[model samples]
Target: MTNFSGEVAALAAACLWAVASIVYGKLGARIPPLQLNLIKGIIAIAFFVFTILVTGELFPSITILPMCLILLSGVIGISLGDTAFFTTINTLGPRRALLMQTLTSPISAILGLIFLQEKLNTLAGCGILLTILGVAWVVSERTTDIGHISTAEFRRGIVFGLLTAAAGAVGAVLSRSAIANTQISPLWAALLRLSAGILILLVWASFRQQSTFRLSSLRNSKVIAGTLFAAFCGTYLGIWLQQTAIKFTSVGIASTLLQTSPIFVIPFAIWMGEKVSIRAILGVVISIAGIALLFYL
Candidate 1:
């Protein structure tokens, strides 16, 4: 169990992110993408700080370079990547946006090979490929819920989705480099990343003369609750798990497992009264086979 802890963490993170995405889809209707990113960052930062304090984990002494890498990872991944993802969600709808996210696995794998010199064995490589294939297949299925999208919107979504995938890949590799051989706790890493991301987001919001703290849409209790829940699950815990995955596993494996959120979303969709097709079911089976290979191989 301990040997595969990273893989497990990555899978768990995907599940939490799946839940968060569902809540975030509703919240996106009421809030702008950047502001939504900022709001969740603030909420998650509070949780990170509280957890660090309660655990009595003092900030570890680290050299400047790794610290800088982590901070940059936060800005790129959380600030830019998340904003692009939210925009993708709005423009393309959650299904297609998630399909776009499937690109992250291969992108991160290539980045890992080039920058980090990390390589996976043949079987592990096959597992990653199968997992990505399943996720892509599942998310590409059309549903009645998705309304009509114009050509311009579709094109815009594709661009942002690609951007999101690139940013996420870069960020993950940077993060993996920072903590792969270090004494940095995943909790602390998550905190630093969230802090840097939120800071940048706040500056960007101010530069645009946008309200930095005005959350009028959150006036509704349900919205507030959902936002808080999503922040806690997705931003706080999910990121910690992600960092843990990067720390313990190869970047390619970690990234591929993280991209399994779409597979996890299947049950959530069913519960929400959305219809699942035979193709989607087949995709899930393939993904599960991939996950099994990853686990037992």
Candidate 2:
């Protein structure tokens, strides 16, 4: 049971992210991507600090090296990666943006194999492949409302999307390295990473002369509620579970499971009266079969 804790945590994180993404999509139109990312980071950081204080966890004694790795992971993964993701969503729409994210699992797997020497067996490899295929298939489906974009903007979005995937993979592997080699609790790890990410965002916001906290945006109750809810589910709890998954499992398996968030979005789509196609259902089935292989074998 303990051995499977990482897998369970990863799946749970996916569910939370699925919920958050829907909220974020609605909020994104009203907020600039950088501002939205910073806002959520601040909110989530507040939650992390409160959690740490309540749990009396304080700061765990961690070596400077592991601490640095975690910080770097946050800078790359949350700051750069998430900002790029938001930009991609704005430029190419969410479906194409999410399609680019399917690259993370394989990239993480390869990185883990090279850097951490965390090789997957034949069965696990097949699972990873199938899961990636399923996710790619679902997100690549054509929609009636595809937005028009200039070729230059399309190219830029593609670049940012790839950057998002690469940064995510690198960040996951770095977090896994730090956590697997240290005694830091997952909660503390999350706090440290988010703190680093928020710091970078603050500096970037300052350099651009953009206000970090927009009281105007908060004036709207809907925006405030949505931001807080999304932050709690996606940034706070989602990252905590993500760190736990990295701590308990190989980066490859953890990343593969984390990438299942898109699959979880299908039920949400149906509940919202969005039509899902037979292709999407087939993708879900394939993804589930792959997930089962990861769990049972």
Candidate 3:
């Protein structure tokens, strides 16, 4: 692979996730975010099983260090992070909720420095601001005027989205810490994450008395299909690409590009005739420029 091949991987991951966003939007209308998350985790676990067999990794060979990192990543990112995101997307819509994700890069960068001793620079700092401002500009232009719902609803969505971004940033930083260790295969790490996510979700559901053992995911085909597809493409493959990207490049760059999925999302929205304003496009451009600037610095 080339020096920056991981970037391509990350970008690809973003593209897949952008598609998943639409699915989640549709799914969220009917199912709860927590329930959706649990289903996605189950689907991801299934994909991980296939991936392990195809990659030819000895499952027994995984070390405790890699397992710990993957488990942490799964709980933090998949379980907690995605649950918040689904809620945000349901309440705020994908275009708006994803705008908060542009913060994931800088947030991860700062955390990486504090926790992993990664270098931080001025250009990267400025780039982070510009990117966030750009995304915010597009999504927030209507915040003061949107009359579809009460102010409380908007606040709740934005708050949940922000929380999701924060948790995801922590997950990205943790993944960087783990990848820097270089003792684990990316596929194996991904498998562990999916498995851990399913375990966590199941444990939570059981504690809450929301067992799938009695309920049929088949009864809710659309949500099940959407969540399953989201898991396969977003959780399994997207995370695979991300782990590879983190292993190859600076976490800052990888995260900046990965979170650029909203750029793709805007076009998807427009294609669906959702009446997108020009500000949204502009914001996506600004965030992309910010990503470039961060890489330049």
Candidate 4:
């Protein structure tokens, strides 16, 4: 149990990320993807400061190497990874894109084992297999006439989501690596990541020639609601819980549980009046199995 502290923190991070997914998911329903990402980061930045003030342990001594690592993780995970995911959700719907979590745990494990030289024994391998199989079960559509989405389009969305998950896994490992080397403070590291994510999007918006970002959009009621939730979950709560978990546990376990965003998204999707399918059910089951194996196996 003592050694499980890290695992416990990972679980907490997963739950928080799950909630953030819900927040951003709903926000996407109402707004453009760029606006959603932009405001989400802005809101998160505010709460991050609040968190620093509230927690006395917020200020850690800063250094260069760890800061660079965490910032890179942010670029990979928050910027590129999330951009792919949101696009997938828009293209494939949350039910389908979320199912991609099934692959993330195994990918993270393999990456960590390769790059970080973390252990990946038989049980871990078995856990990875079961989890993937379960996720496949959850999202596998049976009907030939499932309406609208052609097979090609469906596959495209899955591919995008998987890419997002893969990149995200790499980011998680990198963040963990930085934390392991106590050369930099986690707060500054997190700040770098958040700021970097925001900047990346800033450049993207400029590149795409998006019209002036509107204060009116920011003032929208739903955007405000979503922003608050985003701040709480993604910026303050999510990162805080994530660092705590990673600092305490293996990067593999932390990624495993955080990928459970799909699991939480399922019920939330239903509650939001989206149609639930048998395929989606199977995907959730697979993801849960994967998570269980990640911990218990």
Best of the candidates, TM-score: 3
Ranking by TM-score: 3, 1, 2, 4
lDDT of 4 by residue, 1-297 (tens): 267866676666666666676676666666676667677777777777766788765556757777788888988878777777776676566656667755766887777788779787787788788777766675566433234777787777778788877977878767877887685554656766777888888888888865736666666787787778766776666776677777766655666666666666667777877677766676677666766676556
Q: What residue runs in model 1 are displaced by over 4 Å at the alpha carbon?
A: 1-3, 112-142, 209-214, 281-297
Q: Weakest 10 consecutive residues, lDDT, candidate 1?
A: 288-297
Instruction: Kindly report which residue pairs in candidate 2 clash with one another.
Output: none
RMSD (CA, Å), candidate 3 to true, equals 2.8
At residue 36, what lDDT does model 1 achieve? 91
* For model 2, the run of ten residues with the poorest summed lDDT: 139-148
TM-scores for all candidates: the values are 0.86, 0.85, 0.88, 0.82
lDDT per prediction? 0.82, 0.80, 0.77, 0.70
lDDT per residue for candidate 1 within 1-297, as digits (tens), equals 259999999999989988888888888899889989999999999999899889999998888999999999999999999999999888866655665676666666556677779776677578668866875675555455654766677678878988998898788778887898889999999999889988999889879965655668989999899999999998999999999998888765776688788778878878988776878778866765665554345
Question: Can you give the lDDT of residue 38 in candidate 2?
Answer: 91
lDDT tens digits, residue span 64-97, model 3: 6756876898788878888899998888787777
Compute the lDDT for candidate 1: 0.82
The better candidate by TM-score, 1 or 2, is 1
Which pairs of residues have clashing backbones in candidate 3?
none
Give the Cα RMSD of candidate 2: 3.2
- Runs off by more than 4 Å, candidate 4: 1-8, 54-59, 113-119, 142-147, 150-152, 183-188, 212-216, 274-279, 291-297
Worst 10 residues of 4 by lDDT: 138-147
